[model samples]
Every structure is written in C-alpha cells, then in structure tokens.
Target: MSQPEFDTYATSPRTLTVEDLQVSVGDHLVAVNGVSFQIRRGEAVGLVGESGSGKTLTCRAVLGLLPETGEVDAGTITLGEGATAVDLTGAARPTWDRVRGARIGAVFQDPGSYLNPSISVGRQLVEQLRVRGGLGRTEARERAVELFGEVGLHDPAGVFHHYPHQLSGGMLQRVLIAIAVACDPELLIADEATTALDAVIQAEILELIARLRRDHELSLLLVTHDLAVVAETCDRILVMYGGEIVESGPTEQVLTDPRHPYTRALLSVATIGDWSRRTLEVIPGQPPAAGAQMPGCRFAPRCRYAAQACLGGQVPLTEIGTGRSARCVRLDELVTDASPIPDRIEASA
Candidate 1:
C-alpha cells in the first residue's frame, strides 16, 4: 500500500502566522531560533518543551510584550491574512496598543505578574473592556460581571470589587482569563496558564479554557512543559528543543505515535514511569542554552539514536506523515514504545 499522505489538515482561516521568528537578548543570546507555526481560527496548538526551549519567548514575540532586552531579530509575525494581515514584526507601539488586547489577547503563567495588586479585579476587567472593547464604564462593569460568571466565578459582583491579593490563585487566574477574552480576540496565547494552581484548580482552569474555546470559537496557542496538559487541551502539538521546533503534528498522533527521539523520550517518562516497579524513565542531558553555537542537530548530544551524520551539520525538518514533521536524521527508524529507556538517557531528578 502507498504511504498515507502527510499533508492532511486542510487550510483554514488562520488567526496568527509566525514565520521564521528569531528572538535575541540584547546582542548576545539568541533566545528563539527560526520558529514557524500557524494557529487557525478555533484551533488550539500546544508548544511543549523543557524550560528554556524558547516557548515563552515565542509567545512574547507575537504580542510585542517581550521583556527588557528581548527583541525579535528577524522574520514575519503576521496576524490575520491577506489585505487585513498585520505584519507585527518590529511594529510600532501604537500598532501594538491596538492589536494586542483587541486582536490577540494572552493569559500568562502568573496572575500577579499581570494583575495589579492595588486595583480591584473588577476595575481591571472594566478597564480592559472599556479600553479594548470601547464600552462605557457601566457597560464595561456589567460585562465584567458577565465575564466573571462565564469563567465560573460564583460571586461575580463580589469578586469583581475585590483586589487581586484577596482572591485565591485560581480565582485570580479566572479574573485574568476574563480580561483576556473581554475583547473577544481571535487568538489567545495561554503561556503556562495553569502552572500556578493546584491540581484540582488546574483541572478546573483547563476545563474552563476548553469550554470557552468551544463556546466562543477561540483559537489558542498554549505553551507549557507538561505533556499531559498538552494532550488534554491541544488539537496539535509543536515540540521545541534548543530554541527550535523539532517536531509537530496532531496531538493524538504526536503523543501516542511520536516520530522524534526527543518526543519519544518525553513520552517514555510518562508511560514507563507509571507502569514500572523498577527504575523511572527520563531523558538525560540538558538542552543547549540560548545563543549556543550548535553546528548540528541540537538534540544529537542526548539522543540515543544519534549517528555521525546527525552531528555533522544542521538537520532540516522532515515531514513524517499526516501533517507531522520532525528534525531527526533517523526518522524512519525511530520507535515510540514504553519500554525501558536507556540508562544513559535517564534523567536525574
């Protein structure tokens, strides 16, 4: 039988397209390498990797909210398409002011990091609604109450008046979520949105996000290090390593049938650790730091199947199948079993 065609996902109305995005810190560190991906309307794509893999920086680059000293060095960062497509690459502050909260909203990892402790949650939400949504104070407050209810906050009016510090982490996160969607942005970049909450609260937050996506038809770019979270929340997965996209595909295929050694190594930790009565499974070796001069596949140093060719030079991305891609030199011979991971690659944790 002929091999199944890999380019299976048909085109849709894309909300955001990030092409060849490069991010740097000052003039030294290249935090995000040439990363490219698109989030179509109503789709949820997860960016997963170890910390420092450039997931957060990529998200920051899209909204022009990079931290001090961080900047997008090259490539196109466009929102929408065709005549309406806004090229955000090095866009001015005025353009960012209009596009950020209005066109592309975000919910970051920590609510306190974004929320003002001095201001009431209701006031903040109202400000966003009024400024971004162009509503009157009364209308914005009313809508804030509605959003509070929409995010599953029981005491909408009461919660609105309370300050960020008064509420629990989960509650404050809900408030942030409400602000993120106040303008009904086409794309919501949720970077580690559930990281600060407890397990039960995390589940609740994830469920709320899922419900919002289904009801409001919101597209999401969720960035996290947790594989399980991505499996449950995302439709597609992009695996990042050493500041580059190493593999990408449908979540089900990528999680259950990964073609990259790095991906398989990640899955092995989850599956084998759960089943094993013996040693735990983990991928050893640290990812290359940002700005490191990598002459070959960055993952080659840790990969169990790396050959001499894998270390000689840059590895181009290989289309594996069914909208999947990986940057492995031995893509055809890779395995995704939950058997014992090699001792050399077992993480120490």
Candidate 2:
C-alpha cells in the first residue's frame, strides 16, 4: 500500500494536552487530582514539585504505566491535537503499544534497572527498532548504531556489543536515550533522568537532552524536584503541590516572580543563581500526604500568609496573570500587602 497522504498525529503542534486528570490509588486515595497541562511541538515543559507531589503519577498516567492498584479516576489525557487527538484515559494495551516508544518515549532515573543485564545493549536497541521502527534486522542494527552515536556514545559498534553492566551509569543512560528516540517519538518524558548522576554527569545529560530536543524538534516533559535543572532546560514550568498544579507559566517568569505561596516556598529553598555560598532555607512543614483530606486550600496549613478564609472552602487555581495561575485565595491580599512573603526560615541567632 502507498504511504498515507500525511501523519496528522505526528504533525500536530500540540504534542500532549492533559486536562483535569485524576488518578486514584485503591478506592479512596486520589494521588493526582485535577492536574492539567499541555506541551507544544518542540517545547520543553518541566513538571516540578517535591516527592509525592504527583509529578511522576501524572506522567505515568500519560504513559499508561500506572500500577494495577492505581487507576485514572477522572479527566482526559489527550495526545496530539485536532484530527489525530487520542484520549488516553483508559486506552487498551494495543493503543499503548502503538503510542508508547513510537509516539511517546520515556527515560526514568535508574538506567540499569530498565536494561536487561544478560543481553547486549545494542541487541536490545536493535530489537526495539525492529518492533517499533519496523526495520529489518540489518537495517535495525545499522540504525541502532547510528542512534548510539547520535546520543554521543564513543565507539558505537563496540558499545553495541557490550552488556548493560559493562557501561558506566552515564553510558547506560545514553543507551536508554538512544533506544527512546530510535523511532523518533514526538514526545520524550524524562522522569528525574539525571538525578542519580554526579554534578558533572548531570550537567552533561541535561545538555544532551536539550541538544536532542533542539535537533529533533521533540517536545520534552522533564520531571524533577530540582528547580535549577528545569530553569536551565525547560521553556515552561508546571509547579505541582498536593496533587494539583499550583502554578504554571514560562520558566523564567515562574522562577523569578512566583505567585503561588508553595512555589515561593520552593524558590526560597532552591539552590540557584550565584555560586557564592549561603545558608540554605527550608519550607517549614512537610507536604501533605497523598489523598489526605483537606477541605480548603491544601497548602493553608503550611502557608506563612494564610488566613481563616484560606481554610474556609475550596481554593481554586486562580488565573492571576497572563499565563500564571496560583491556588491561593489570599493571592490578591498578599500581592497588595506592604510586607512581602518573607523567607520561610532564616539563620539561627
């Protein structure tokens, strides 16, 4: 059969659009609630928050890798835009097989665990290329080698035959990246992809991801707790707290002038900017546990500027500015308050 006129899904400008996603664990515990965001073609968006902030869960829901006990309770995860848009809320295995790797790719923190210890890494890559890329054995091997080289692995032919254990952590990660993009997936999800690496390696990997995104015009969804990482790599940022997006906007805008109190708190503690050493601050209270019952604003208990009204009822993620939203009822008052939102904790006397 002749090739179709065009691939609408691959050409769609909006690579991923998640709307009001709700993921529940067991029956009562909602791990991710009312979360929403979108990533345009070639856009790099960061999903950031402390651990248990539903960052990973939201990504998992999109990738269809949620645990058996966990289920997408509500909302829709739309992949692509217009005629090719697919609702991935409860997509079947075949749909996932078509999307994952081919349309969407992912890289997680641990690289070793994802690779088969007994098999040669190149063989694995070749297999994926044959299956996902629809290439013959010889073509798949050639493409796998090219991908390894594309990911900056030296001696691509030599590395191809080496087992996963033979490669260093960074090398293994590169192998994973090579496999992830072998099929030229439209979206790449990096869930703490560089967290386990040392400072130098981390920087290298981040630069690699950035370069790959630029070269391939791939939409990137980077998940991490490190604000500094996102600031360097992502175009836009979505700050999550208590299973919801507390703030979303351009990375520079969100980092510099955060509107949400939680975002502010995170900034106060984030190690960014100058190299000069300074006492690190910390947010006062622990984050709310997943599915924890909170009638009003989830961050009210920990917010320094919180008032009675904050805890009175449900506080919406109010759009406060152009492309900025904050889940704080006191945003108006806090903005006009003479005293700014002070640093959470200062140096001890």
Candidate 3:
C-alpha cells in the first residue's frame, strides 16, 4: 500500500523519503514509531531531540546500519524518485553496499572512533576512493589530497601524511567530512558531526558543512540535540520526542514560534542565538523511556499544560497552520488564543 506522504512527495524530485518507519530493539521494544519525513534534493533538514529521543535510531534505519538487536518492523524507506526509487526496507546486502557510502554517506559525532588509528587518515580515504570510487591508486592519492584541501584543512599535502592520533579533533573531523563527500554522494547524514569539537572549531565545521552542501548540492539530514545548531544550518526542522516527531516545519517558524510544548521547552533551554550564553530554563523531567507504551501524548507527563483531555486518547499530528504540524490535542485552542504559547501553557498547567 502507498502512504500519503510517499504519494505526495514521490512526484517531486526528492532524495530520500521515509514513510511510517518503525524500528524495534529486541523482541518488543519499538524505539522508533510511525516516523515519516522527506528530504528534497539539496535540502538540509534537521532532526532535533534530546538523548534517547530516537533521532539516531531513525537515521540508522535509513542507513541500514541498525544494531544486531534492532530491526525495522514496519514501513518503507524509499531512495530516489519514480521508477528509479529503491525501497530500503528489504534491500539485500549487495543493494545496501552500493547505496551506503556511495549513494548516501554518513558522519558521526566522534570522528576518532570511526577512523583507523594505525593508518594515515589520508590513506584510509584513499582506500575508499579506490575501492568504492573505482579510481586508480595515483588518482586516489591526488584526489584525497584535493579533498583535504576542500574541507579547509591547512596544508592539505602535509595533513595527508598525519595519522589520526597526530591530528587535532578538528582536523580529524575535517578528514571524516572529506571522506564522506569523497564519492560525491547525493545524500549526507551527519549525526552530531560537530558535537565533539570545541566552540570555535564547531562553528568552523558547521560552516564547512554549509559550504559543502551548497557547493555539492547534497541533501543533508543533520541530527543533533541542539536547536541553535539547526536554526543556523537547516532549511527545515523535525522535533522528536519519545520516539515520535512531535512537531515539524521550517526552521525559522519552528524556532520563533514553536507549537509543541517540548519544542518550546527546548527553545527555552537552548543556547541563545549568538552562542554567548545558554538559557537556564530546563524541562522538568527526563524524556520517556524508548519504546515505552503510552496512552496519549508521550510528552504529557512533563508538559505543564497537560490535562485530562490530553491523557484521554491518542494525539495525532494535525495541521495547525501553513506547512506546520504539531501532535497536541490542545493545539487548536492554544494556537487560536492571542497570548504566547509558553505563557498560556504555563498559566494553564
């Protein structure tokens, strides 16, 4: 059966579309539930959530790298569009080998962990270029060095000879970026790619990613816990909570006027736009345990405005305005009121 989102987005020139994706760990724990989203060609989308919000799990599902205990129990993940679209839900290993890294690349939070400590970082990239990219050894070396320079590593030739241990954290991250984009993949999944770097270096890495996206015309799925990062780098945002996308829309609209209480709470505690200081406000409780069954909204337990009605039944994501949706029963009431959402939620709760 075709999904509404799939049918709606398939007509467009999209790079990736994940429809009704449900990921489960072990026998019964469903970590990601009914999650659906699409990334357009050259579009940068942010997947924002706290730890254990299933953001990374969702990305892993798309990458076909789920853990041994994890499996996609339901839904379809389609890459490309129309006749060329490949459904990743049941793709064989050989199909995955061709798609991952070559067609769709990924970079993680810890660059060091992903790299080989013994080998020169440049040599490692060269191996991928030769093996996956099918370039001659000499061509691979020259291309690897060129890539190093492209990612803003100073003295590209010199950096090529440095081992992972010898390079600074920032340098190693740049190497990972170079490797990820080496194949000229159409889609890039950056899972907290800048989380391990210092503030200055983090900004530099983020700038490089933005530049790469523009220069390469790559579709990006950037996963992170920070809203400010998404606000700066993403075209659209998906706010996840308790293994579901609680809210989604344009970055500016979501940041400036968040519809979901969880999103509002995130914004309150987020680092200020200037990165000068972080807001001290904190969400009252930890995120719900992954795969924990709930009767109504998963965030209701912590939401100040949660009421009996909120807990009475399921809360489906409903359209509140143009190009925006929120999974809250009281969204209509809250959005219609003239007062601020947070203020009203505070007073009501």
Candidate 4:
C-alpha cells in the first residue's frame, strides 16, 4: 500500500522539515517511529511527552547526536530553505558537523556534561564564538562577555573566568544558552534545558529563550515534559506517546481541550490546583519498550477506551478541529466524552 501524503500537515514554510523520521537502536529497537513535524522561521514548537516517549531522541536526530548504536532507519530530515532540502538521515557526519553548532544550535539537558571541566567558562564561550561564529579571538572574547550578560549571568567577567564546576546549575544553564545562541542560529533545539533549575530560575530561563527568539527571529524546537512550560512558551505543541506523536495543535487549543487520551493523561499530571477532595489520575502503565514491536497504536494497551480496531491496523492522524490532529481509533468518542481530569493532581511542588 502507498503511504499517505504529508503535505496536508505542512503548515509552515520553514527551513526545517522532519518528515517521517524513524530512529532505531540496532536492528530491533526503535526509539522514534515515523515522527513528522515542521519548524518555521520565527516560531516556537514544543514536543512534550513522558519519560522515554521519544521527545529527546527526535530532537537528537535533528541535531545529528544519535548514539553510534542508533541509526535513522527511515524517512527524511530536510534543513534549509527552498524546494530543494538537505536529506540528513544517512548523510555524512561532516555535513551535520558543519551545521550542528553553527546554523543549528542545541542546548542540552545538563550544561555540565557539555562543558569542558578544565576550561574556564569564558574560554569555552570564546572557542564556540571562534569556531561557530567565525570571530577573531579578541572579537570572540568581547562577544562571550556580551553573551554572558545577555543570559543574565551575574558578574559576567568573574563568571567567565571561573570553571564550570564553580558555577551554580542555573548559571551553567545560562552559559549553555549563551554558547548555543552565540552565532545567532536560524534554528535552536533545547532539550529539557531548564529541567534542573528551580521554579523561579526555570521561569527566567524560559523568558530568556522566548525573548531571544523574538529579538533574533529564530526558530525554536523545545523538547520537554512540562505542559505548563509548553502553554507558556510554544506556538504549536506536539504530544508524543510511545514513539509517535499522538496529538498536535495550537498550544492553547491543545491545552484547553485535548483530543487524545494520552494527552489528557499528561495534562492531568502536570496541572496543579486544589486536590483536597479529588483523586489524582495517572496513566496506569509505563511506556512500551523500545525493543517491542507492535501493530496499530502503541498506546492501545493502556487506553481505557481502546477497541479491537485500535489493534487491527495502523492508526492515522485525523483532524478533529481546525489545525488539530490526533492518532486514535475512537477519536470522536474520546473528544465528546473526554472525562474531566481532577482540578489538582498533587499539591504544587
């Protein structure tokens, strides 16, 4: 049978296109299965999911950071503008090397892992400026200091001179952001970039990224598990379950009225309010193993309203409302009789 055309969901005229991307570990384990999304110029897209839901793996594939054990089994990852797109799935390492930190920047989950322990933060930032931004040593130094200030690091000069270990988690995260945005990349991928910080710090980091995107007209792809963060920052949100996107729509619409069971389950956990009289709802089982191959919807096993049809064949993403889509067999039932999640899950942390 022929595959369905994806142009129907190509809502953006962006330089980045992830078309049916599939990443697997060895021959049997698939971390990401047939994921498709687009990142347009000057827009922010959020990929939200529970742990092991392929959010990070999807972003890593785009950045060419998939482990050596992993491979892009199917699909195309196109970058840049025009009708002609760069096919990055099985491309040479040098091709992605040229674009990774230059044209496309990435802010990883932990800043310390990315930073060299021996080098002073200033030197690291300067090196990125020199290599990625193509600036002279003196010019790079100036830019590094300016970037430090931009990311809200205190005593920019002093922090620059200190090593990564000397800086706090929040400070290191700022430095990572500085390095990622050094060259003013056209696209930025932040993978749980603020997960380690406190609430106040996370807010600041989110605001910083938002401001940077607006001021520089940058396209952002944020991978996170926080629904609140997506609501606050992203223009469009994709909800991933198992290894594929289960639902996607404008952030506000998706949050306000989710059409997928998995999405509703996720929002149920993330949203906090009064929980005194209600029981918290949690998705019963863990995500299926990456090694486990299955037909139909991977989420069917855990879905409360799943039918035999859900396991009979592949489920297609169907549009439920304007600019909204969900991959479900009983999408109409799920939407019409979507149960009300409790006002509060657990008390706000």
Candidate 5:
C-alpha cells in the first residue's frame, strides 16, 4: 500500500487534541495525571517544567517509547486524518510503527546518546530511512545527503563518512536533526534538544529547528524548562507541575499575565536579567516524590497563597480567560494581591 498522505491531513488545519491523560509507572504511582492540550498544524506548543515534572514522560507516551514501568491509565490523543481522526491512545504498536517516524518525528536531548557512537553518521541516517521509512538503500543515501544539507551541515559528503565520535557536539546534533526530519514528519517533538550545547550553539540549533518548521509547515511540541527558550520559540506554552498541567495559554499571555502561583513563581525565577545583584530564586521545597500520593493540590504544599480550598481536594483545570486555563482556586485573588512574592529558590542539582 502507498504511504498515507499524512501531510494533506496535517495541512488541513486540524487540531491535535489530548484529553484526561493519566500515566502510571506501576500499579499505583501516577507519573502524568490529567494532562491535556492541543497543537494545531503549523503551530508550536511548548511543555515547560522542572526535571521530573513528567514533561519527558508525556512526550514519551506520545512517541510510544514510554519506559517498561510506565502505563497509560487513561487518556485520548486524537490526530487529524484528512476529515477523519486516529485515536492514538490504546492503539497497538503495529499501528504506531507506521506513524512514529513517518508522520511524527522526535528530537531527543543528548544527541551523543541518541546516535550510535560506532556507526558512521551517514550509515545511521540511511539505515533509519530504509528500515523505518521504507526507502531503498540508494534512495536513502541520496535523501540523507539532502537532509544533511537541509540542516545546514557543511560538506554533506565529508560528514556522511565521519563517525558520530568524529563530529563536534553541534555538528552531531545537526546530523541527528537531519535524521529526524528525513521523512518530513508532520509533528516534531523536541525534548530539550539544545540543553547540552553552549549558548551560541544553542541559539543556532533553536533557529535551525524554527527554520525547518517554517519551511516545512510542521507542527512542533517543544519541551524545555528554560522560559527564555519558550519565549523565543513557542507560540503556546503549558506549565506542568507534579505530573499535571498547572497553567496553559498563549505564550505571551501566560508569561506577561500569569494566573497560577506556580506559573508566576516560575516566571519570576526564569527572568534572566538582574543576576548581578540578585541571586537566582526557585520555587521553595522540592517536587513531590513520584511514589508519594497527596490528597489535595500537589502544588499546594509549596504555594505561598495556598488555602483551605487547595487542601480540600484536587482543583480541576479552570478556564481563567480565552484559551487560558490554570489549576488554582484563588487565581484571580492571587493575581491582585500584593503579598511579597519570594525570589526563585536555588534548586539543588
């Protein structure tokens, strides 16, 4: 059978809807609870939070690469299908195998680890094209060169012959990106792909991804903790905490007029300027342990404005404005109150 025309569906301007996503590591411990959002074709959505906040796990679930311990307890992930739709959750691996790399591609953090150290970069790239994408070896090599050039790698032929260890960090990352986009996947998931690079290289990598997205009219799910990165790259942002979405909205709205205390705290700490006179502040207290269970709001323990409402039960994600939602009880009051907000706490490594 011919490859499904996913691009046509992608370009039809449909929404990628996720609802009531709950994932568990084992029988009792939940890693992602009630996570939901939408990514429209040709738009960028960012998932932001500290490490262990389930950002990575959520993306992994979508990619069908969840750890062996992880299980999807409940959720619905719908991808547009040319006037139809594909329900991603509960779909078998065989079904996902067709979509994973062809229609959706992922750029993971740590390019060094993602790429095989012993294999030539060209060989790895071509191998993926042949096995996963169903291209012949000769066709794959031809496409691989084009991909290398597309990602701004100089001397595609020379780099093709080099092993992963022979390339610099930035070059290796670019090569990995080339592999991910080889098939022109409709959705691209970038999980902190630029974190390990230096600032200058980081900027270059981000720009490259943005350029590729624009050029291909691709939808993006960018996962990162850096608010600055979100500000620069994302059209919409979702703030996650303790495995749930705490705040979500247009990037500008959430950053400028934050609703949740946790979202505000994250923004206050992520602001990059004034570092000389002020120490970097972080949210007070560590995130709850994965195995631990809580009765009320998970963020209530660290939230300065937490009240009886927070301690009573789980706060549903409430719509505070058009296309904006947050899981906090006193959201309006918290925005207006002039209580001294603490500086970002320095999180431990």
Candidate 6:
C-alpha cells in the first residue's frame, strides 16, 4: 500500500539552505561534517538520528547556540528567499541577534531551561516582544495574553500571571510555542521539541506544532531520533550517522525502501508498522566518539556490510534517484533482492 500523503511536510519554495556545513569542537572532533539540506517555506523537514549523530549540533549551528568550544569551520547557511537572503555562517553576531526569533525561531527540548522561573510566563513573553519585537509594554502584555489564547491555553489572562512552575508540561510547551511563533519567523527549528514531554503530552505538542505550521505557513526543521514521530510529522526525512547525512528523501521512500545501510538499520530498530516479534532490534555499537578521525566511512565500524574497501577516503553522496542521495560506497552493491534490506526487516524483528 502507498504511504498516506503527508501534507504537513509538503514541498514549497526554498527559504533556507545549508551547504557543506562543518561544525567542530576546537580543532579536534568535528561534530557536524559536511551537512547540507534545505527547508522550504511552510514545509516540514525531519532530521533523524541517534543521539550524538550531530542532529542537535546541526540545528544549534543555525541558532548560534554552539558551545564556547565549538565553531562553524566551513560551509554556508543561507536564510530567506531570493535577494533578501542572509548568510548565517558569515554574518556578524548582531546579524544573528536580529535574525534569531525574528526571521528564525527555535523551540528546543526543554522549555524549562529557556523559561524564567522567577517571572510570570506572561511577563517573560512580554520581554521577548519588547526586546526582539520592539513593542511597548502594554502592547506586549496584551499580545502575550492573546498568544496564550492562540496556543489553546485555557484562561489566557490568568495564565499570564502564572510562573514557569505553575503550568503542566503541555501548558509550558504551549507557552514556548507562543514565544517561538511570536515574531512569525520564516524558519522554526524544533530541536527535540517534544522529547521531554510524556507520551500524551508529546502527541499534543507535535499536533500543536503541526497546527501552527499549517495555520501560520511556517517552515520547520524537526530534530528527533523517533522515526515514528518523524514518519507522522515530516514530509521529507534526512537520516544522520556519525555527524553526516547517510540518506535523505521523501519519508515514505526512505522509510519503506531505504537506500543506505544506516537508514535501513535505523528502520530495523524503530518499530514502524509492527512486524512484531518476541525481541526488539537495535543498531549494534555506539557512534564513534567525538573528533575521532576515520579514513573511510564513519559508520563502517557498525555497518554490517563493511568490507576491505569501506575504509578509504570520505564517501560521497551518491544520487540514487531524483532529489534522493545516500553517502554509502556500496549503495549500488546493496540494492538488490539478495541484499535483504527490506526483506530481512519484514521477515524478522
């Protein structure tokens, strides 16, 4: 059966693009290696990978949230459409300050971390409006209350006086969403946005994000390891391994008929449509520690099909089909009925 049409991640004209993005911690370990992708206005893109696969790092690079030790060593990050574009990698700090939360907004894993405990949720939101938005205090306060209501919060007026500790996880997440969408950014980076919430809250948060994107025509880059979530939320999917994109394409094609071994292995571990068994499957071996230099494919250590030729120079992204590519040396070699990429998955756990 064909996968259901996912309009949430539907394609639109490109708004943001990253090319050859290489982020590193000092001169040592490179956290994000030659990462590149594009997010079109109103389209949702999912960046899926194991923890430390550089998904978070890649998102942070755009938000200017890289740690003190980290830096964008190479590549270009362009935001905006047509002639209005800004190069994020080369732009000044003041430029990023202007872009952040205005042209580009971010919703991260922990709302608590960004929320001010000492202040009322309404007050802090007003600050964002006044500072980034340059609204007067009264106008900002009114806007904040309206935003609370917009996010489906009950009693937006009362919630305005409530502090961070007063609201439930879901409510707090809504508040964060309110702040993120306050300025109507062109691109919203949701880095593990729902990861900290409970299963039910997770669903609510994702649905809220989906609704916001739809209603506001917001572009989104959802960062998460949950294939199930990505499958439900994203139109386009990018699979990452060892700080590099292994495979990327439409959600259906990549999930059902993965081209890269890593993509297939990731699907093997994620419980998708349920080929149930007594035991669960997992990708063997951890990713290489940060900064570890490799002569060939970084995933070769964990890749089941690793051969003598696996360890060479950097594997290039090979186009398997239109707008689809995989950074696997043996993409063609593995594309056969005998390869058992999907067959094994369908047959076993």
In the range 146-260, model 3's lDDT, one tens digit per residue, is: 9999999999999999999999999989999999999999899999998888889999998898889879888899999877788788888899999999999877778777888
Candidate 2 lDDT over 158-239, as tens digits, reads: 9999999899999999999998998999899999999999999899888888888879989899999998898888878899
Which ranges of candidate 6 are over 4 A from the true structure? 1-11, 275-278, 335-349
Among residues 3 or more apart in sequence or in different chains, the pairs in candidate 6 whose N, CA or C atoms overlap within 3 Å are 29-291
**lDDT over C-alpha atoms for residue 184 of model 1:** 90
As a TM-score, model 2 comes out at: 0.92
Report the C-alpha displacement of residue 98, candidate 4, in angstroms.
1.8
Q: Model 6 — TM-score against the truth?
A: 0.92
Worst 10 residues of 5 by lDDT: 1-10
Error of 5 at 106 (Å): 0.7
lDDT of 1 by residue, 226-263 (tens): 88788788888899999899999888778767888888
Instruction: Tell me the alpha-carbon RMSD of every candidate.
Output: 4.5, 6.3, 4.5, 6.5, 6.2, 3.8
Model 2 off-target regions past 4 Å?
1-12, 335-340, 343-349
Q: Candidate 3's error at 222, in angstroms?
A: 0.4
- Tell me the deviation in Å of residue 48 in model 6: 0.9
Query: What does candidate 2 score in Cα RMSD to the true structure?
Result: 6.3
Query: Per-residue lDDT of 190-250 in model 4, one digit per residue for the tens?
Result: 9999888999999999999988987988889999987878878888889998889999988
TM-score of candidate 4 against the unseen true structure? 0.90
lDDT of each: 0.85, 0.86, 0.86, 0.82, 0.83, 0.85
Q: Report the candidate with higher TM-score, 1 versus 5.
A: 1
- Number of clashes found in candidate 5: 4
Candidate 2 global CA lDDT score: 0.86
TM-score of each: 0.92, 0.92, 0.92, 0.90, 0.90, 0.92
Residue 249 error for model 4, in Å? 0.7
